[model samples]
Target: MKTDPKQTLYGMSVQELQEAVKAIGLPAFRGVQLGDWIYKKNVLEWTEIKNFSKADIEKLAANYDLRSLDGSEASFSKGLESTKGLFKARDGHFLESVLISQRDRQTVCLSTQMGCKMACSFCASGKAKFLRNLTAGEIVEQVAWIQRKTEKRISNIVFMGMGEPLDNFDATMKAIEILIADWGFQLGGRRVTVSTSGITPKIIEFVERVDGRVRLSVSLHSSKPDVRDELMPINRRYNIDNLIQTLTEVHSKLKREITFEYTLIENINDSEEEARGVVKISLPLNAKVNLIPYNPIREMAAVYKTPSKERIERFTKILMDAGIHVTLRKTAGREIDAACGQLRLDREAVSAAGEPRTKNHEPREPAS
Candidate 1:
């Protein structure tokens, strides 16, 4: 497929913009000016850049796109203000990002890839065939688009949406630099998180790259190696023992808090023994456990069910009794199929069936 020609200026760093401007026959300082306009001023149109002459503006416009969420496809949850943006890549495949609103904070969950190859059995994202890695610009644009749409400041960003962020290490790191740079979003390094399904080598590289400034979350659904290996195929390559050891070394060096995301699936890994296993692994590293009750996806509903309230509470108690900091994460945008890849899957279904697509804001039954 033919790709889109116009390059995006929104995600470029000051140095990168300078290089780009030099390539376009403009003075190097012009690139810094472009970076300020796009990142700080949030300018969408080339004409809005007043510093450049009309001819120069036209020339820059011809080779670059100042795109944001202004005209992109979006859907909002009916019951809540949660919105999902469907960004069409240059190759015409759609990637989804979600904006979740709660209290005063707006958190945008960004996707690093069109689809996931991790193949975690319980995640809807892994069910979709792997497409391609999203560029640094593409990943950064998701936040820019959501911020423009909601008219609210995005306080936190989580790489917990559709893909294994560590798998696309270079682009993901570049996006992080863009997010935390003073000239870019200026978000605090601690407020931004990159969650991985235990890609051991990348985890080590991530810690070294950011020097443990950016928060890290691991999707450690189960503590048992056998159970984790079955649920997350990546475990076959990097098992719990190796993952925990790496995390231990990184944490000891940086003393940054590591979060382990545990999705409690009933009859799978929700038993008291499993909770004790989590406690054992987490206590050694002083990790915070974010317990997520499994969100049922149609493909895995028959085999997986969310742990009951009692089970969830009991699990939390086990960790707390052991001095482990734990929080039960509230499932947001369930009514809108907001879980990982649900929105993208829904869009694909609609297209395959030749149905008219519309913005759906009403609360509906949860995905089967």
Candidate 2:
């Protein structure tokens, strides 16, 4: 099937809009006006452009198709708490996004790529290996799709879904820009965060460009070099020292507190000394630690066990006593593979007898 040329709306930046208007026999300044309407107005339909003449809207609509990534499949939490799902692209590649509704806020966790290259031991996203990155339009479409179904407007976004935001750095940042642009979603940059699995160089790249406007969450799953190297294979490439140096540079430049996500696995990295070591290595960056109890993943289930709630609380207290800011993040949507790296598009790749095979999970609910 031929992809729509009008899909240009997804990847177009402000300047590109100016060029587009001129090419379509319209005034260059009209591009700026149209951009303000489409992005700032958050209109997904070309007819929503009131400033343009009816003919102008017709021409644009004929050339470009404003697309939305509707929820193809949805799985809610056991009791209607959270929902997760695979949002299919026009090309049939599935990327994961979750709508998490809390009493105070509604946050959408979006994926930037079809699959992931960073094969962290505990994440299911890496199981299918890397696929192509999603365009900025594709990224933003996930939010628009979810907004239509929920009673509340999405208040925040987290780039902590299937793929590494930094791995698909260009598209990821563009999507963020679209979300925060005065002519776009108008969400504050501070409300949207991009989590990385230690893509060291990209961390610096993000810090420099963001000007302390956006939030950064680094996946620091382990403190020991060898353990981290084993748990997250990306560590072997970026390692801990180099990662620390880059993070320190970011902290120095931005003077912003970084968030370190430590997924505690039973008998893995949840000891008192391990918590102390986390503080020792992380203090230089003035980072806050987010202790995550391990979510049972298909591949890592045999090798890892979720730390008990008592253990998680004790570990968090150790950091707090050391004057470190810490929060033990309660796992959301546990009934439906709610872990950061648990969204994989392998539902049909199981055994045929219909007795659910436990490889990862036998297709749990999405967007719970």
Candidate 3:
């Protein structure tokens, strides 16, 4: 894609980088040098890379963005518990990437699009209008930027940040390849989990692509058709029943880590009926359930509420009783941007308050 001239080199494979360099008046061998600088060295600024002359840096930067986080910005929660980086696409739209730390694990929840089209009621991402799909490079850059700032190695990658991963199919897959390849981030497929709002066809395509190496998570807020349709607008197109039926198609083929990310809303979907409904859907496929009690989005505060402790425990007990493995997700980082798309919303709020912000700045040339 970088051969297209307009495309950036941030997400290109070593081969593509080589071809891209040769196409832009540089030797093919420069691709090896460039790849090492971007992926291995994890350089986020062009000027910081060594062994390149100022003239060559200009030639390379002209065609491809050498660094991923050139003009990105970050906001961290108190105690540095969670951090979010708002990345600016070339066209000037913004997307978010969140870094979460658990005992020994550093997980980066990455986004695939500018804003979500899924429009799930409990989410903060859809509050902003959908812009466009993020390029593979942009998706990969989130990790580099987040890792650089926090100085922690990312142990796991989750696509549960903002956008639906399957909607941006090709780019998401390309980004995954760059993430898992030995020449790239070098993480295994199991370390990366792709979450979706149940795009059936694309989900099937995804599992097949990686041969079920990468984990899959579906946003199944409710098991009932009407409730699911209301929570996730995408369900109206691909109903929950049909979506699970679609999962059954590939479940046996690879038997990968299939998870149902159920966000329990107070009175909305925390009842006994809802819990039973979840077992019925997950039983046959052996899919695990990750229970995320709804994190109230400030803009939609009146719309949803987190379930009480007793209710949450009851909800989890029902699923476990049915012999389904379940994980109850604890909410982290509340004081400073607890929700997924809130950081971008925070920046928006700042801008709306008439504060001057700069996301796009002139690239500094490398010194001689």
TM-score for all predictions?
0.92, 0.87, 0.91
Error of 1 at 352 (Å): 3.4
Task: Report the Cα RMSD per candidate.
Answer: 3.6, 3.8, 4.5
Model 1 segments beyond 4 Å from truth?
1-4, 68-71, 78-81, 357-368
Question: Which residue pairs overlap in candidate 1's backbone?
Answer: 78-361
lDDT agreement with native, every candidate: 0.83, 0.77, 0.82
TM-score top scorer: 1
Off by over 4 Å in 3: 1-6, 356-368
Candidate 3 local lDDT, 2-106, one digit each (tens): 533366778899899989988978898888888877776678787888888899899888877664434566566667777767776555456778888888889
Worst 10 residues of 2 by lDDT: 345-354
How far out, in Å, is residue 152 in model 3? 0.8
lDDT of 3 at 174: 94
Name the candidate, 1 or 2, with the larger TM-score value.
Answer: 1
Error of 1 at 263 (Å): 0.7
Clashes of 2: 15
Position 2, candidate 1: lDDT: 71
How should the candidates be ordered by TM-score, best one leading?
1, 3, 2
Over the stretch 1-368, how does candidate 2's per-residue lDDT look in tens digits? 97554456655777888788778788888878866765655565666667778998888777666564534456677766677766656654567778888788889999888778888777778776677888888888777666755545888999989888998988998999988877678898888988999989889989998888778899988888988988899998999899988887778666467899899999889998889899898777778888888888777778989988888888988899888988876667788777654545454243224455574335643331
